[model samples]
Target: MVRISSFGVGGKHKSTKFALYCVGLFGLALLVDLLWASSNSSPSIYQSIVSQENVVFPSFAQIKEEDKKKKDGIDKKRVLADNFADLDAPVLNWEKMANAPVPRLDGAAIQIKDQLFVFAGYGTIDYVHSHVDIYNFTDNTWGGRFDMPKEMAHSHLGMVTDGRYIYIVTGQYGPQCRGPTAQTFTLDTVTKKWRDLPPLPVPRYAPATQLWRGRLHVMGGSRENRHTPGTEHWSIAVKDGKALEKEWRSEIPIPRGGPHRACIVYNDRLYVIGGQEGDFMAKPGSPIFKCSRRNEIVFGDVYMLDDDMKWTSLPPMPKPDSHIEFAWAFVNKNSVVIVGGTTEKHPETKKMTLIGEIFHFEFDTQKWSVIGKLPYRVKTTLVGFWKGWLYFTSGQRDKGPEDPSPRKVLGETWRTKLEL
Candidate 1:
């Protein structure tokens, strides 16, 4: 019998031990890498792994942090809030006229030649009207009514007017918490008839509309309760005496669901103000989601998209507001005013908020300033420049008791004449 004593196998045993040590180290490295990859294996990571068969790749864990940032949905091309740091200069004082109309909000107004055409708005809880409220600056009168072909009770829809026609886009028509139709309607100043246009590709409300190069441009709004929608642009075109043709185009998508009431067109660039989030739909008997049960407003960041379709972040509004159905308007060619919109309460109250702040940004100065407030306690106030005055019309004040409770969608009117 060959006796193999404990210390008898000299050099050969030493070599075997060294080999074992090296194998153990290799195993440890492999184990560490497997654990790392397992920890970082998302669906994308797995897809990558499945594609690589024999290659010893770096652990997914090692690169996971970097991948998460790259995978984020935030827009790199769009500039957002904070670009308006240089926009704090005082606004050029425009003349102010208070002897206008009754205090109200959430109405549509337009400009025709030298006149401001004010139309439908809600007055109190459960009251959405279709009164075509008109304001004549030359005559200094408030109660002139044009009969609309069909009455619409909506808030936060895009309200725009060419020198010849007035257009009302998608908006919420019922109570403060209700949703509006996704329809487009226009009023011919000459014919005084309401004609429906091609409906939006999707149903939405609270979008921004402005006239650019004779084309009526519309952007932003909520689609099915989601605000950060990808669909962002549409326009209307008319040829001399031909019927109006509606054309829909896509611009660079906004970062999220809305441009909301924070949209204005100045010097051809579109300035989108703060927007809101959460569900605003009112299904007949469905229970409201807890998150949507109360007001859940969003960022105060201001953003501007120039004609070149480039987005630049602007300094935030002095005060943050969201879901303000009527919180955005052009105070003048050089300023933007945001009116009755709130961020704290879901079913926004009828407690009138006169803090209707105006943000005046001069294109020449590239600055912003908070100017005056709207006259009446209001919500979703739409402003149109006509005959050298700003028209405020139609919106909800006090919402009703329950989801479908009686609430007012007003139809009154007011006017603001700037001193600039």
Candidate 2:
């Protein structure tokens, strides 16, 4: 972990010129008053106009913190208050599932029939993982272990399942995030092998992927090796067998979806939330310096794409506006739940802090419910919803602040029953 800090400085600077103008106006008023007093006749019309203008005066007083914060376009109160899940809030029964045979962060999970397949992602060994780990839902234990093609050892790749085949999109190959690969493959759950399939229209890392209504959706991730964001939306029609001659087509939206934002499918609508646009790695673990595009937002912007391809911006998540990346999951396309991710790094210690607060957004009310806090600290993790269970795995996690232990995840997978 490296210490990250950003610097920015800007202001209107009109105060100085305005003060000079006010001083000149005051001097003119004094001269006019002297002439009016010396004259026996009534004051001039222009002098009367000056007197009226003088009445528009206000006393200089100290500005409150809240008022100042409001002027600065930030609500510190809301962020500080809503950053945690209450200890006494609520919790459904959560039990440990089979420990992840391949525990890695930034990977993905897909359930087909009675088997759950965990795909490639960046691992704790400081390398990208191509090893495939599977767990059987019927047997309640780990299943087959396989390896991805050497070139497909990609991390941060877009992954989605059509129940039979898991489509693995482009992602970074080496430990560094720069080596984004264009090789996409599909895994057969029944055969336990991967086959070459239709690659993406363009190459990108960390692109959001979802399967809705027989169409595969990939949108809102960085392009050009994770340097810039493009509003390219690509979809492919998947039939029984894997065949593609004219399968992929791209459409440019009016306003592009958020780059690197957490995306999920809900209620037949595609949603992207709270992700950095240009670069998610330029200043990893860095603190925000100014209000601009360079700094990744704390709670990320929210958007929903309609069937007509129109994008609608929704209310921002009510969490601390730090740059640490978080994760979200949807329970049956109805309720959206956000869980563990890192918070802002401590200034002196320079350790990137963790967020314990868990929240569920209320659609009808436009508010967030501080549901409950996680017992452990999380930096990066995958949220997989299979059947009635929610599986959490990977991430550089640790014990919470109260535990006084260095925060880290020991590479274990756990699950809890989520009653939708």
Candidate 3:
């Protein structure tokens, strides 16, 4: 080989050229990476999950201490609240309007085309709310009351809409309303007409109802009594505003049901809440079971049924309260608000419970925190939305002899804005 370098000077000069070439290559590679990232518009900040040890439940005293810290001008808690708050902070000042009508609980509610429709709930042995109330957001009107084909009570049954027709799922019927019903019906919101649909295979009341991927998902709910909850699931596909008769598909199983009254569609998983494990006989004279003194021990368990039709148990609720009738609502795409429910011994004769607390679940972090308690313990239906603000309505409170009409139902509505 012909020698290109004679001694140390030439060798050192070659090394310098190699070093500059390596540096130039690195610079060119970085520039290309920056251009690719810019072209793809990738976010500068990427979310990463850090492994965390299992969290311990907060005691009442610990909760009080945290609240104190939040209220004591501590910037950490305040800033955390603002950062993790639901509903965008920009639209926190939106005006809220109420559509007051008759008091109703255990009714079905859904929003379609920016309008909310409520229908079919029970009141007393002799009274029931069969009239459907429609609230139009665009017009700010609330006067489309239609009657249901039948009345139901204490039933955990739910209703959903395909934007045109309302599908009323299985529920309890008869006086006292403890009878198991397999009947399914649909009401045309446009025509104000009702039609019977094929009944569910098994009789269930209050299975968490949600629309999953253009199909209906009914999760855990009570069967004969509240203690005997069913874990069977059902899915139905509707085309042309009508359910396809041949499209009912059985999906995954859920955890046991308890008077389950709350379910919502999020990330294609149905999150079920507040199921009962005791006897709940809405029937006139059905035998009540004595499983435990805690008549209404709310389930602290949170199960997420994913898109693959598999159920995953997320972190449990912070507390337990069974009678949280319709207490689940999606506040946004990534958060949900589980509102007030009942904890019982029946306050009268020292066997009553009335709890008024609200819990919020942050889906992204799988964390739960207590927001605040309600003015009073409530036992009623809950469904609403976070249209830049959280709007909830229509629940019942504790009953008394003077107001003893099976707890005069609530037509009251509330709005809370999340600072975030």
- The TM-scores of all predictions, comma-separated, are 0.60, 0.67, 0.66
Candidate 2: residue pairs that collide: 84-357, 85-357, 274-300, 298-321, 298-322, 397-408, 397-409, 398-408
* Candidate No. with top lDDT: 3
lDDT of 2 by residue, 88-178 (tens): 4476555766677655766666656666677766655355677878777666788678888887845667777766878777776666444
Q: Report the lDDT of model 3 for residue 246.
A: 53
lDDT of candidate 3 over 1-420, digit per residue (tens) = 866657778889899999999999998797667544533542222112112655233344644554575477555534533322222212223344674576666666777666777766655544556667876655556777766775333345666766687777887664244566877777777788777766777777677777667776776677765456677888887644567765457877776666655676666567776556655444444454212332454566777877576778888766555545456666667887776665434333434344455678888898987766554456664556646555556767756422211355687666566543
Rank order (by TM-score, best first): 2, 3, 1
Q: Model 1: runs farther than 4 Å from truth?
A: 1-105, 151-153, 173-179, 226-231, 239-247, 283-292, 322-333, 336-354, 373-377, 382-420
lDDT of 2 at 128: 62
Cα lDDT tens digits, model 1, 332-393, are 66665555454333223422222344555566676656656544334455555554565655
The order by descending lDDT is: 3, 2, 1
- Shift in Å, residue 152, candidate 2: 1.4
Q: State residue 43's C-alpha deviation in candidate 3, in Å.
A: 60
Each candidate: how many clashes?
A: 49, 8, 16
Better model by lDDT, 1 or 3? 3
- C-alpha lDDT of all candidate models, in order: 0.56, 0.60, 0.61
